[model samples]
Target: MVLPLSKDVSGKGVNVDQGSLNIKEVIDLLNGDAWVRLVASGAEGTWSLRHLHAVIGSQPPAWPDHDWIYGDIALLRAKLSIDRLKDALVAEDCRRFSVGSIEVEVPEVGPQVGWRRRPSFEQHDRERLQKPTWDLRVSAAQTSQHQLNRSGYLVGRSCPSFPDLQYAFRAFFEGDFSLNGGMSLPSELMVIRVINDEGWIGPIHVTPTHIDVQVDGRDLLGASLELYSTDQRTTTDLNSPNTVTFELPGGLPDTNVWLWLKKDGRWLDYRALYRPWATPDQLEAAGVKIDLPVDPLSTIEALVSGGEGPQVEFKRSLPETKSKDRNPYKTIAAFATMEGGWIVFGVDRDELTVVGLEVDDINGERDRLANLIRARVNPTPPFEATPYVIDGKQIMVLRVDSGVSPPYGIAVDPDAKDRPEYFVRRGASTYPAWPADLREAVMSRQPPAGFPNGMGGLGGAFPG
Candidate 1:
């Protein structure tokens, strides 16, 4: 339960009435630089609360048993003291108190500049107090998932087999009653925790219509699956053994589903699920271009005018497969090794012109290209072959996906002792994969860091 201090920060008044105290009043008090004291008289004792200070990332000597001290110092101290206040209130011992009286040690100093403080906003009057240990669990759960590309085709998360996502919690303040500026404020504090009751859920599959997930080897008689996104949540009861399928009301593309859980009546962490999902901002920060034009004409014009880059390649005609120079197999292998991109045929490489293909059968050529890729590229990456008419010219675009199986290489010889050559794309040209590039591509294909072989497979059936 949170007891709001007085409106005056000069240690002059106390608000104890449970009917009138507002959250904005409390935020205004904490957002100041004045030193506030909680002077209380209860059945067991009469005392004032003392505050502690700790640096953002340093372990302060005051909290000796704690491994580390961090987070908002004022809020941390307030949270700790609030736990005590709550205990007294629950025991019916905190009878009367002044929670917002200003201390004499800290003079009338205004709010400090270039410092962190919770902004004054509308909030619940009663706030939940959390323990220092709570931070570790949340951080661990969030960082466990592997980073993958944000494919427009997939709207669900991929996790290491039986991901150890811990039980999650949410804390907030809810106003119950009100109080005057000088008296004690009385409220009930609630701590809510959501347990992942089934523990393991997946080998999940999500399509445009429904989500199907296998429960963690547990009886699903009373279980349910939930899809949460964009401040909206929908839950569906299990209809079959060891699995639950949820029909999305708004469809998959409109809702980026965050949680795919098998639970009885518990909630999951939205933030933890969000860590594996890449936002456009996150992609840009990682140097992945996300703002490329979607229109084929505009995109092709830009590609032709700007020449080629890491993700865009142009060829005057079909790849010269007989020679190693400017081989399409190498380009395909490079796209698989890096973030996937396009290979455009019927475009002049040097002159930057859209010279259409002279082929009689575009469909046959696409099939031949597919066959060539299958025969030449080992452990082939997924791609889409489509013929487009740009400038009244026939052009082929092979849209490749970032390979799930990486360090893709081209077959050098079906009978010789030569290694299949790996390739990568850098700065507008296909190049031999450097040792580090090969290593990173290999690592990226592996299960996210920390999962061992005993864990379930890392693959999940996504839309892509």
Candidate 2:
């Protein structure tokens, strides 16, 4: 006879009550399929299960199955399922395994079984049928799988592919099969060796259309490499050095040629390019030398003596103003009002050409002009007059100093009442002074006397 099924002490038919299960037994059960189901239910309640084997075992129940019960099974299952859902919904949240991209989660089972037991069933079993789906298509597209093999992407590995395509193409053209370092087409065709300040000369032989000359490993483009030939001028384009050719005209004689490279609109010498050749003395003996002069004044004197000065001539007629006589007073006043300058007599002011002076005695004429300026001009200007010889002709030069106090007034056409005008020099050209400029000039001319050291003297202590 089948004895009445044994009942637990709680009077439940061995289907133990939730509270009678020990913490260890409950955790064990939760680690199984039951945990996944509870996580899916999203319930606020708690449950328990009894482990008869552990309770009946000896050794004071040291929490048997410690290896399998190390973590919070129920919480782990819930978090795993939630992450799975997020991976399915979010484009970037999918897992990237060695095989491929896919979504993964804890398997679900009936309420009685635990998630740990789900993997035990065969592939055909309904519970074991749980498999990762390719819902990670978007993530697979977003993942940089190919980039993973690049340098620095992973620790202790080298990139199998080059990062820059231009470098690869250049390497191929240059007959370099290994695309490691950056490469490019040669831009410079000819190279010359020079010495000191004398000159430059050499024969540059290149196989390809162009042979690059790298300075510190950098390619110079659009630069000009200048070479001076005994009979002709030679220049090569930095970008297209192959097409541009520089020949010495009559087969490079024993004489040297001056060569230099220009890049970024700046000239670079042989020393800068680190090319070796002859010394300046050797080059000079070879009839090659730098074109620049050591002394600029000497050059200027040579040019002037060579009849290069402007061909200037003076007009016989004088300037016709409303005034009857020469306004010597106004002329002196205007000169004194600006920086001291020369006012050459017998010279046309507009044409700036000198006319021969018509006078009896050159020295006496200059003295007479100086006396006229001093007597007629108001507020006598500090000045001097002398006769200067230009092209074998005597001309009076009146050198007037700037006024000690400016706004040096001049009665323009002194005879006219309202025609009084004022003039000042801005730069090389003269301009009619505005009222403000006149006032500023007048103030600037005066010494800083009787003025207060600070604002406390007159105007209130500076405006805030």
Q: Given candidate 2, what's the lDDT at residue 398?
A: 56
Task: Kindly state the number of residue pairs that clash in model 1.
Answer: 20
Off by over 4 Å in 2: 1-331, 348-353, 412-421, 426-431, 443-464
- Best lDDT goes to which candidate? 1
Q: Tell me each candidate's TM-score.
A: 0.37, 0.26
Please list the C-alpha lDDT of all candidates, in the order they appear: 0.44, 0.34
Model 1 agreement with the true structure over 82-103: per-residue lDDT tens digits: 3332232223444222332321
lDDT of 2 by residue, 6-47 (tens): 334234443321223222222222111111111111113221
How much is the lDDT of residue 81 in candidate 1?
34
